[model samples]
Target: MAKITYIEHDGTRHEVEAENGLTVMEAAIRNMVPGIDADCGGACACATCHVYVDEAWLEKTGERASMEESMLDFASDVQDNSRLSCQIKVSDALDGLVVRLPEQQG
Candidate 1:
């Protein structure tokens, strides 16, 4: 499992352990992390699960897919580090992934 940290816009933090095959979005939703609405339930069809991947962990999380990029265009406060959590798969390499939520989802 990987330990993922989800920090809300207000600085609230929720650290969760996610199984290898789960998406970061799944871990947040399963652990009840307040800022990740995950409205489309990991389908990459909405931007509610948008997050800013910690710069330190960006390489491990990998690049956003074309579909994810399209979806991110609909999110609020898009950034160079912005990503759709559902597009990031959990793995041993991402053991300490950290993501920050926006003030509000799109």
Candidate 2:
């Protein structure tokens, strides 16, 4: 299982163990971790699961696709490192991955 650390705006952090092959959004929602709403499930349709990946771990995660990039257009307070959690698939390489939640999600 991959260890996902989710950091909140106030610095409070929640770490959860997630299985491989599951999307980050799915893990967050299933584990009841605060931050990701995943309102559109795992369809990559809604930007509710928007998050900013840790700079050190960005390259460790998979590349973003054109559809995910386009959906980010609806995200609020988007940053250069912003990514939709639903687009991130969990894997052994991402065992210790960390994703910071935005103050406001779309």
Candidate 3:
């Protein structure tokens, strides 16, 4: 399992063990991490699961696909490291991955 840390807009942190192959959004849901509404499950059809990948882990998380980028246009506070949590598959390489939630989901 990979250990992932989720930080909320208010600096609250939730660290949890994520199963390999599960999407980051799934991990958040499993661990009861607040702020990830995951309105579309893992379908990547909505921006409610948006998160900002920590700069140090951005490369390992891979780049956003065109569809994800397009969906992110509806998210609030989009940033260079912004990603749809559902689009980030958890893997061994993603252990210790850190992401922050935006102040609100758009």
Candidate 4:
């Protein structure tokens, strides 16, 4: 299991255990974290699962695929660390990883 920290808009941190091989969005949705709408489920179609991962954790989180990169253009407040949580597979390597939730979604 991996420990993921979800940072809220008000700077609150919520920690939860994430199962390996699960998507970040799946973990968030399963844990009932706020801001991860996942309206399209785990599919790459919707950017509603957008999240900003901590830059320091980027290397461990791995790079985004072209599909994720292309979709981020539609994500609000896209940044260098922005990623679709649905496209990210969790692993023990992701333990202690932290992702910030965006304020809004379209």
Q: In order, what lDDT does every prediction score?
A: 0.93, 0.91, 0.96, 0.90
State each candidate's clash count: 0, 0, 0, 0
Off by over 4 Å in 3: none
Q: Per-residue lDDT of 43-74 in model 2, one digit per residue for the tens?
A: 98989999999999989886889999999999
Model 3 residue 42 CA deviation (Å) reads 1.2
Worst 10 residues of 2 by lDDT: 33-42
Question: Compared with the true structure, what per-residue lDDT tens digits does model 1 show for residues 33-86?
Answer: 998899998999999999999999988888888999999999999999999999
Q: Summarize candidate 3's per-residue lDDT along 1-106 as a digit string, tens digits.
A: 8999999999999999999999999999998999999998889899999999999999999999999999999999899999999999999999999999999986
The local lDDT score (0 to 100) that residue 85 gets in candidate 2 is 95
Q: 75-95 in candidate 4: lDDT tens per residue?
A: 899988999999889999999
Ranking of all predicted structures according to TM-score, beginning with the best and ending with the worst: 3, 1, 2, 4
Report the alpha-carbon TM-score of model 3 versus the true structure.
0.98
TM-score of 4: 0.95
Residue 88 lDDT, candidate 2, scale 0-100: 91
TM-score of 1: 0.97
What is the lDDT ranking, best to worst? 3, 1, 2, 4
Model 2: residues >4 Å from true position, as ranges?
A: none
Q: What is the C-alpha RMSD of each candidate to the true structure, in Å?
A: 0.6, 0.8, 0.5, 0.9
The residue-level lDDT of candidate 2 at 87 comes to 91
- Of 2 and 4, the candidate ahead on TM-score is 2
Model 2, position 61: C-alpha lDDT score = 82
